[model samples]
Structure formats: C-alpha cells, structure tokens
Target: MSDYQVFIGGSAGSIAPVITILSSLPADFNLTITIVIHSGTDSKVSISEILANHSALTVIEIIDKEQFNPNTVYVAPSGYHLYVENKHHFSLSVDRKEYYSRPAINVTFSSAAEAFGEYCIAILLSGANEDGAEGLLKVKRHGGITIAQSPKSSQVDIMPQSAIDNRAANKILSPKEIISLLLEYNDLA
Candidate 1:
C-alpha cells in the first residue's frame, strides 16, 4: 500500500458514503483518514460519536496540539479549520475562513498537498460547491494523488465537476470503489 495520508472532502447534506468506506477498513490497515466536511445547520452535533458508532475505527474532533495516529479518523470540527502541524499531529484555528468556509475542504487539502507532497492522496466526494478545486490543484502540483467521486453518483455534482474541469483529479469513481482503492494502498504499503 502507498504510504500516503488520505484527505477526504464531502458534503454535509448527510454523512457521506466515503465515510462509510473509510470506516470499514480492516483493523490492521495502516492509514489515517482526515475528513473535511461541511458543517451542518447546528454546530452542536456529536460528529465524533456519530461516525465512531459504526466505524471499525476511532473518531475524534481534532483540536489544537493533538498527536495523530494511524488506523484512526479525524473529523474537522464544525466551525474550525483543521490543519497539520506535522504529518502526524493536528492543529485548529478560527483565525479566518478560506473560500468563505470554515472547516474548508480547500484549506485542509492545500495544506496536506504541501506537507505530504507525493505522500498525500486527496479525494473529493459528494458536495455542492467548487471549494475543493483549488486545494486539489495544490495536490496535483505537488505530485499527490487525487480522486473524485463520479459526478453521476454524487448527490451534488458541482465539487467533483470543478475538480474535473481543472484536471485536478486522477480518478473519478463511485464512493463504493474508493474503499477498495484505499485498502489496496494499505495492502501495498
């Protein structure tokens, strides 16, 4: 499997299929899944518990100065942008929002693109805006792997379309298949 960090971008219309996929990984899988999702109508939802409930993985709302771990998932908080301090640790800030969004997919992805370089993999799943396009561009420019759910399967098509339009994504598959690909990377690694 590839020794790359996987960054996922998805909508808040509901929890995403990609989340289900990431949560299903085998216990021994050697990877971390950092998800950047749109916050819901209320910022008080217990996303960590909700996601952790069915996942075979651990989930946490990332906070400043926390160490990261493999076989785990970090959910960016509802109103905070999640960022990396080192490849294996996390940081949070409310200093500003990017692309008019806090917990913006673009900000997190762009940082991962630069921090991990070729060791990063970015996936844009179901969502409504072009928020992830610039971030995915950063990934592509830095030689990171990029994936987008096929717009046909996306509940909302704009995000994936934007990535495709800019040639920022490397693969465009349905959410179900992304799990296998991520597992394949884990197996190879």
Candidate 2:
C-alpha cells in the first residue's frame, strides 16, 4: 500500500462495508483511497461526510481538478464522471451516463489503471448493475491487482459477480477478508 492508489466502486448495499474497511485502517495508512458509489441525481446524501465520521482518515467529496494526496479518502461527487487526469490531479465531467450512472465505476477504475498501472489496486463491491466489470478487467490487463467482493458476501451480487465472470478479479473475497488483505499489503509496504 506504499505507492499504490486504491479505487473502490460499489452500489446498492455497499456503504456498511465501506465504513467497516475505512474505520479499520490506521490513521497513518499510506495509500490513497478513492471511492465511487451510485446515489442517483435526486438524492442529497452526503457520502463524504458520512464516511469522514466513520474513519480516522480524511474524507472529502472530490472537487474538479483536485490534486490528490496519499492517506486521504476521496469520494466522487454524484452526477459527475470522475477521472484521473494524471498521477497528481482529478477531473470531473457531466459526460453521458454509462450503465445508467454518471459517476460510473468504469470511468474511474480505467483511469486509475492508466495512471497507476501496477501500483493500482481496485475493488468492486456489491451492486445491482454491471458497471465495474470492464474497468476492473482493464486494470488487471494493465498489471494491477483487482478484487471483487465474493458474491456470497454481497447484499447485491451482480457487480462483483460480473467482474469474476469477466476474469477481471485476481481475488474474490469477503468484506472481512478484504480488510485483512489490505492490512497485509500495508504490512509489506
């Protein structure tokens, strides 16, 4: 987890697991965590604030062209497609929705693979749709490690299952297992 940048994507019943993982990490965790969740346009929920309250790491809704830093948790803003413009900054767009989602998981995950390559670690969690599979595949092809939440552990199995089906995930793990693996990576770092 030293120079690695992690991208997590989820929908439907993913919040609880996200909180669990974030809260379990140390304050000095040395990786950048970027998250994308589908909350829809009509929703006014503040996911960044909610995550911030549950974790020791700093959490913020990503601002357009924001410069990213390690140890911070960045949540993609709703209704915009979040992209890693480069290794240092992020860009946002009102691009046409993919998989009926503006902040599509595929967009960020693919961008992260290009920007970080083998240093990228992407995780696709529970979701009702198939948004993340292709992007996760791209990451794996780029030599990045990709993990999909075990279907048995997901409240909604479609998303992670799609990744598994597409051969995108190098590992399929439960939430608890995911946390442990992350800590293991940190230890190696």
Candidate 3:
C-alpha cells in the first residue's frame, strides 16, 4: 500500500473536531498526520498536550527540521510557518504571517501538496479567514484528495466555505464523516 499523509488546517473552533478525529484512530493506524492551526503567540495551554490526552497515538509539537513518522500526530508550533520538507521531514520558518496569523494553513498545505502530491489528503477545517483556500486548491491540482469541513459543521464557515467556493474541495463533510473517510483511507494505506 502507498504511504498516505494527512494534512489538516484550521483556526477558530477547530480543536474539538481535531481531537475527535485523532482520538478515533487506533494506535497502530498506518498513516501520518500533520496539522497547522492559526494561533496567537500567547496561547496558555499546549495544543499538543491537549491532543495527546485524547489520542492513543503519539502527539508532538514539531521542531525545526524534525523527521516525521507514521502513526503519529504532529502539531505545528506557534509563531512560525510549517513546511513539509519532504515525505520524511519537516522544516520550520519564522517568516511573516499570512492572513494575520503565524503558522498559516496555506504554508503547510501547499508544502504538503508539493512534497506528497497524490499521496496526500488535505482537509480544511473551521476558521475565520481564507488562508487555506489557495493551498487546498494546490493540493487538488496535485491530484491529492481534498476535503472541506461542511459549513453546517464548522463554527466559522469562512475557511471551509472559501475552499468550497474556490472549487478545491472534492468532499464537503461533517466531523463524523471526515473521521469515517480518514479511517477508510488508513485501511487503503
């Protein structure tokens, strides 16, 4: 089976759904997940820690030039842009923010599209801005499957709606549907 990498991006009201998706995956699931969420520098709690509490798989806050592994969840660090350097590693940059936020979804999603191509599954979740729309489009153009959180399920519809509006999302689904689809993809991988 081909290696599948899942890239998820979100901002407002995305954490709960992310936890739901991760917690549902078994410990031995044979896929990698990388996440980028727009966050301010002053976040009081560690997102990775929160995710780890809910998930059976290991959850890590990505470090610069860190190697990636399957069956693990990686969360992008705040105040930097996350880039998938290749299939096996990630690189971080402190470049200027996009869409008024650092760790912009666009940077990571676009990088994943380049690095993983058709092996990637890109999901755009709830957010307040249009940051991830173009990146999701790139993922689609690269032959990756792209999904947008259904506006009905999103706390803030602008993010996924933008992807849908741009015709980038191949599927628009609720959180439960997203988890089901991801589990199916894991089986294929």
Per lDDT, the best of the predicted structures is 2
Error of 2 at 121 (Å): 0.2
TM-score of 3: 0.97
Q: What would the per-residue lDDT of candidate 2 be over residues 111-148, giving only the tens digit for each residue?
A: 99999999999999999999999999999999999999
lDDT (10s digit) by residue, model 1, range 1-189? 246888888773427675578557877777788888886646565677678876787777788877768877888887888886677677888868766678899888988987899999899987777898899989999999999888888888888889999999999988778888887889877
C-alpha lDDT of residue 176 in model 1: 76
Q: After superposition, how far is residue 122 of candidate 2 from its true place, in Å?
A: 0.2
Minimum summed lDDT over a 10-residue window in model 1 is located at 11-20
Estimated TM-score per prediction? 0.92, 0.97, 0.97
Better model by TM-score, 1 or 2? Answer: 2
Total clashing pairs for each candidate? 4, 0, 0
Candidate 3 pairs with clashing backbones: none
Per-residue lDDT of model 3, residues 1-189, tens digit only: 338899999999899899889989999887889988888678798888889999999899999998978878899988889999988799999899889988999999999999999988999999999999999999999999999999999999999999999999999999999999988988787
Better by TM-score, candidate 3 or 1: 3
Error of 3 at 58 (Å): 0.2
Clashing pairs in model 2, backbone N/Cα/C closer than 3 A: none
Cα lDDT, model 2, residue 110? 94
Off by over 4 Å in 3: none
